[model samples]
Target: MKAYLILEDGSMYEGKSVGADKNVVSEIVFNTSMTGYLEVLTDPSYAGQAVVMTYPLIGNYGVCYDDKESNRPWVDAFIVRELSEFASNFRNEDSVQNLLKSNNIPCISGIDTRDLTKRLREYGTMNGMIVCESSFDMAQITQRINEYRVKGVVKKTSTEKIYTLPGNKKRVVLMDFGAKKSIAKELQKRGCEVIVVPYDTCAADIINLRPDGIMLSNGPGDPKENTAIIKEIKKLYDTDIPIFAICLGHQLMALATGADTYKLKYGHRGGNHPVKDLETGRTYISSQNHGYAVDESTLDKNVCVPAFINVNDSTNEGLRYINKNIFTVQYHPEASPGPGDSSYLFDKFMKMMED
Candidate 1:
């Protein structure tokens, strides 16, 4: 069926509907990754937003079960420049269309996704709607776009209750800030007994568990708004157990340590951000999302910044605790839907546990 996307700004693009026959409206954003579309679709971080793939041809390899970052697709909608019909990969068990159809997600293809990406870059991400071309109404579409809500995104995506993966190697407690399942899988792969707690779990409760380490997971929303978590992290700061964080987690860690964070006018929301490691002078291309970052100037007097700024935007990407076994990165080391350049951080966490 003929489909068209109507942005809040009244800009429209025509396309073909490839998945379920339904209208979808969401805050539209874009990703620059050339591959890993399945992982991107399934990641909880993309919840409540429609994702536009910058790469012209998508679904060339089809969808495979093993590539999922979460239990199911969380994105509100999917858009691409072209939709590959043929399933080419050896592990392909489901076509991309079938995958989205099964999940009841609305998808639009055969559009100028590059143009959409350009608009997002220029105007920052904004709410939009994918509708049947025959039913388009500018006023209704704009009203729907304005009504889109991206708040409380973490709660909508997080697990309803506690869950556990059995392991005895090391007890790791993860604060679920809309965490992807891959984070749990990574800990399980390391033989760590992973206990995933709710985002609002008290510091005393976590300490009572006597975990070998604690992990602050990536989530949606401004880090400064989560005041309780900041207070909680402060109580754990002096603990001897190793503490590691990622993305939003990293921002919260900085806040908990008396640092401040600020929102970017046009935030980093793509997969190709380049980050440098100040300790080793090594640079790695990283995947990132979120609109706010810790202000390096507000760091504690003795605190040290371990990660250099993103080369393109000069935003903070990593930090370390002075004389303490604590650190965090403003990128995805689990990298369920992007490059694995920073995966070594996982091994570093393991080594920290050993020490």
Candidate 2:
């Protein structure tokens, strides 16, 4: 069936429909990863947005259960240049088309992804709608696109109830702000008893749990908008518990400590980003998926120090608190569907807990 991706600016691209027959309106962004489309689709961080794949071809290896970052796909829509014709992987259980269709996600193919990505890079991400019908009213569509906004996405994606995964080592209270499953798995692999909690859980309740360490998981939406979460984080900080955070959690941590954050031009959304460690003077290839970054200029150097920076853009990637057992990184160290170069950070968190 014929489909159209209409942006709020009135720009339209025609394509062929490949997933479920549904219309979707949401914030549209792009990813530059050459592989791991499955992981990208299921990542909760993409909760309120449609993703444009900058890579020419997607789903060449097909889909498998073990590759999922979350239980289900969270992307509102998927846009790609071309969908692979054949599923050839030995571990393949389903095709990407079937996976999205089963999840009732709208997908479009045969569009110029390069041009789309370039536009987003130049003009920044915008609200968009995916129409799968034969014909539609352009005026109404543009109005809907312009009026739409992504809000409360973190609460929608976060876990509804607290759950525990038992282990024999140190106890960790993982506050899940729409966390990827791999974050808890990484902690469990190291023998940490993981207690996953919702995004709005209070700091006093967390303290009552008597955790050896605290983990702030990645999530969706603008960091500055989550004012309540930031306040709770400040209360958590007063406890002096060893804390480790990733992606959105890192931004919230900075906000809790009185630092400010700003939205990026197009934001980092690929697996091959390079981040340099300022402390050790080493560079590591990292996996990242975020739209906002901590503003280094707004940081209080007396309380926190920059730890890692992006090699491509020199943006802040990691930070360490002076005289405190707290640190956070702007990239994914678990690497569920990307490189494992920075996985040692998990061990670093464990060492902090040990001390």
Candidate 3:
């Protein structure tokens, strides 16, 4: 079937519809990763956006449910240049088309992804719509695209109740603002019991659990919209528990500590980005997928200092709090579809809890 992609700027492209035959309007962003489409599809951080893959071809390796970061796909739509029809990997359990169709996700293929990516990079990400219907009013669609915004996605994706994973060592309370599963898996790998809690859980309730440490998880939407959760995180900062945060968690911690965050012109959403640690002076290949960054200049040097910065844009990547057992990184150290260069950050958290 035929499909059309309409951007808020009035740019449109015609393509072949591949997945669920329906219409969807969402914030459109692009990921530069050449592979790991499965990981991108399942990442909760993409909750409020439709992802555009810059790679020329996708579904080359097929789908593996085990590779999913969440219980289900969170992206509103998937856009690609071409969809592979063959599965070449031994681990392939199903085709990517089947996965998207089964999940009722709208997708468009055979579009000029290189041009689309260029537009996103040059103009920044914007709201767009994927329409399967050949007949539609352009004015109304553009209006919908213009008025669309990604909000309250953390609540929509967070766990409704506390979930526990048993372990033999230190207890960690993970604040799930739409967390990726690997965050808890990393803690479990280090012999820590993980208690994943909702975004709205108060600091007193978390303290009542008597955890030795805390984890702030990655999520979607603007960081400033979460004022209540920010207050709770502020309370978490006052405690002695060691805390490690990733992505949105990293941004939230910055807000709690009197720092500010702003949206990137064209966000980092790929695996090959370079990040340099300020203290060690070493650079590492990091996997990142966020459109917002913490403003390092707003930080109080005595309270917290920038620990890492993106090598390409010089934006804040990580932070270290003085006289506190707290650290946060804007990239995914869990390394779900990216590199393992920064995975050692998890060990640092474990050591802090032990101390």
Candidate 4:
């Protein structure tokens, strides 16, 4: 069936429907990763966005149940240049198209993804609609696109109740703002008892648990919009407990510390971004997926210092709080579907708790 990806700016790309035949309206963004399409699809951070895979060919390796970052795909829609006809991986359990269909997510294939990416790069990400109907009114579609906004995505994706994972070592309370499964997996692997809580959990309740440390998790949406959560995080910061955060959590931590954040032009959503450690002068390839970054100029120099920066864009990647056992990073250290170079940050957090 014929499908069309219509941008809010009136730009359209015609293609063939490869997944469910339903229509979808959401913010459209692009990912530069060549592999791990399944991981990207299931990542809760992409909750309100329709993802466009920049790497021409997708699903060549097929889907595996074990590779999922979440229980189900959260992306509103998927776009690809070409959908592979064959699933050839030894660990393959189901085809990509079948996965999307089962999740009721719509997808479009055989489109000029390169040109689409170029337009997004020049014009920035925009609200878009994926129309799979036989016939549709363009006027109505454009109206919906202009009125659409991605809000409350964190609450929609976060766990509603607190859950515990028993372990014999340190006790850590993980504030789950639509966290990836690997974040808890990494803590469990370190022998820590992980207690995953909802995003809106109060600091007093977390302190009552008497955890050895706290972990602020990654999630979706603009950081500045989470004003209530930021206030709660500031209360958490008042205590001396060690804290480690990633992605959205990083931005929130900065905001809690009197810093500000700004949206990037196109945002970084690739697995091969290079970040440099300011303290050691070492550079490492990191996996990133955020649209907003902490503004270094707005940070309080007396309270925190920039720890790491993106080499390509000179954006803040990591920060260290002075005289406090708190630190955060804007990239994924768990590396569920990317390189493991930054995985050592997890160990550093463990050491901080030990001290």
Candidate 5:
């Protein structure tokens, strides 16, 4: 069915609506990944937003049950330039259309996604609406987009209760603010006993678990919104246990360590970003998706800059404690739907645990 995408800034684009035939209003952001649409759709980090895939041809690899980052689709809606009609992978269990249809997530295809991406790149992320067969009144959609509320996304995506992933090696306590399961898999794969807790978990409660290490997890929203978590992290900072974080966790670490954070004009959301290690001058292609970044000036002078300069924009990418075992990356080291270039960071975490 024919559809119209109206932005809060009074911009409008027409396209064909696929999947669930319903209207959606969410923060519209574009991703540059050529693959992993399924992972993007299911990622809890995408919750409360509509995603526009910059890759022209999507769903060609088909959808597999095993590639899911979360239990279900968290995105408010999906936008694409093209939608594959046929499932084409060996492990294909279903078509992308069927998966979104089954999950009640709306998608609009056949739009000029590249142009949309360019616009977002220039104007920054905006509230947008995907309406099916509605009267093409840009004013109404724009007003609706302006009225939408955008807070509490992280709480909505986070697990309501604590859970555990058992292992026999080093005891690791993970604070899951909508963390990807791949993180636990990495820790467990390295023989760590993983205990996954909810977002509201306290520092004393975690320390009482007698863990050898603490893992702050990735999730949605600005890190400054998580005041309690920042306080919790502050309480844990003086402890002797090792700490590791990724993405949102990285932001929280910065907040805990007296660093400031600010949102990017249009955040990094792709697999091909290059990050350079400041000390060693080594570079690694990374997978990233977050709008906020830690302010380097807020970092302690004694602290070392392990990773620096995201090639797309020279922003901070990683941080390591001055004389401690705490470390974090602003990009995904687990690399669920992307490259494994930064995966060695997990091994380094294991080394810290072993020590």
Candidate 6:
């Protein structure tokens, strides 16, 4: 079936449909990763958005359930230049097209993805919809795009109840604001008893858990919209136990400490982002997927300082708190689909708990 990706700017690109025959609108962003399409599909951070794979060919390796970052896929739509219909990997289970159809995720293939990515980069990310219907009014589609907003995504993606991943060394309370499974896996690998909690879990309950450290997890959507969560994070800030945050967690903590976040022109979403550690003055390739970044000027100098920065645009990538064991990074250290260069940060967190 024929499908069209219609942008809010009235641009239309036609492609062959490769997913469920449904119309869906989303914030259209592009990722530059060469592989790991399976992880990108299941990542909760892509919630409320459509992902355009910049890589020309996708799904050659096939889908491995174990490589999924979340239990299910979160992307509203998937756009790519070419779609590999066959699976080739030894660990392959199902083909990508089948996965999309089963999950009701709309996908378009054989489109000029390079042109689409350039448009997103030139005009920033825009609202777009995939329409497989033979006939539809462009006026209504554009209207819907203008009215679309990514709201309440964190609640939708977060865990419904508390759970524990057993480990022997340190008791770490992981507040899941749409956290990836790899985050808990990383903590478990370090011999830490990981307690995963809901998005609305209060600081007092977490304190009652008698945790040696607190983990604020990565999530989706505008960070400022989470006023209540930010207040709870403020309370967590006062505690003596170590705290580590990633992506949205990093933004929320910065907001709790009087810093602000603004959306990037075209958010970083890929496996090969380079970040430089401020203290060490060394750069490392890091995987990242977020639209909002902490405003460095709004950061309270005495409360926290930048620990790392993006090499591409000099955006704040990490923070270190003054007189505290707390540290936060805007990029993923868990790196389920990216580089493991920054995985050592988790070890540092374990060391903080040990101290």
**lDDT scores in order:** 0.85, 0.94, 0.94, 0.95, 0.86, 0.95
TM-score of each: 0.93, 0.98, 0.99, 0.99, 0.96, 0.99
Tell me the lDDT of candidate 2.
0.94
Residue pairs with backbone atoms closer than 3 Å in model 4 (clashes): none
State the lDDT of candidate 5 residue by residue for 1-355, as single tens digits: 8987888877788889888998889989888888888888888888778999999999888899898888898899999999989877799998999989999988899899988999999999988999987675666767789988567877888788877887888999999887887888899998889988888889999999999899988898888999988999988887888999899999998888788999889898888889998878989988888888988877776754546678768899988788878988899988877899988988888889889
Off by over 4 Å in 3: none
- Model 2, 21-133: lDDT tens per residue? 89999999999888999999999999999999999999889999898988999999999999997888899999999999999999999999999999998999999999999
Give candidates' CA RMSD values in order: 1.9, 1.0, 0.7, 0.8, 1.4, 0.6
- Lowest lDDT block of 10, candidate 5: 300-309
Worst 10 residues of 6 by lDDT: 80-89
TM-score leaderboard ranking: 6, 3, 4, 2, 5, 1
Model 4 TM-score is 0.99
The clash number for model 4 is: 0
Q: Which has the better TM-score: candidate 4, or candidate 6?
A: 6
Using lDDT as the yardstick, the better of models 1 and 3 is: 3
lDDT of 4 by residue, 263-304 (tens): 898899988999999999999999989999999999999999
Residue 271 displacement (Å), model 6? 0.8
> How well does model 4 score by local distance difference test?
0.95
Worst-scoring 10-residue span by lDDT in model 1: 300-309
Task: Tell me how far candidate 5 lies from the true structure as C-alpha RMSD in angstroms.
Answer: 1.4
Q: What's the distance in Å from true for residue 15, model 3?
A: 0.7
CA displacement after TM-score superposition, residue 326 of candidate 5 (Å): 0.3
Q: Which prediction has more favorable TM-score, 1 or 5?
A: 5
Question: Can you write out model 6's per-residue Cα lDDT over 209-243, one digit (the tens) per residue?
Answer: 99999999999899999999999999999989899
The residue-level lDDT of candidate 4 at 305 comes to 98
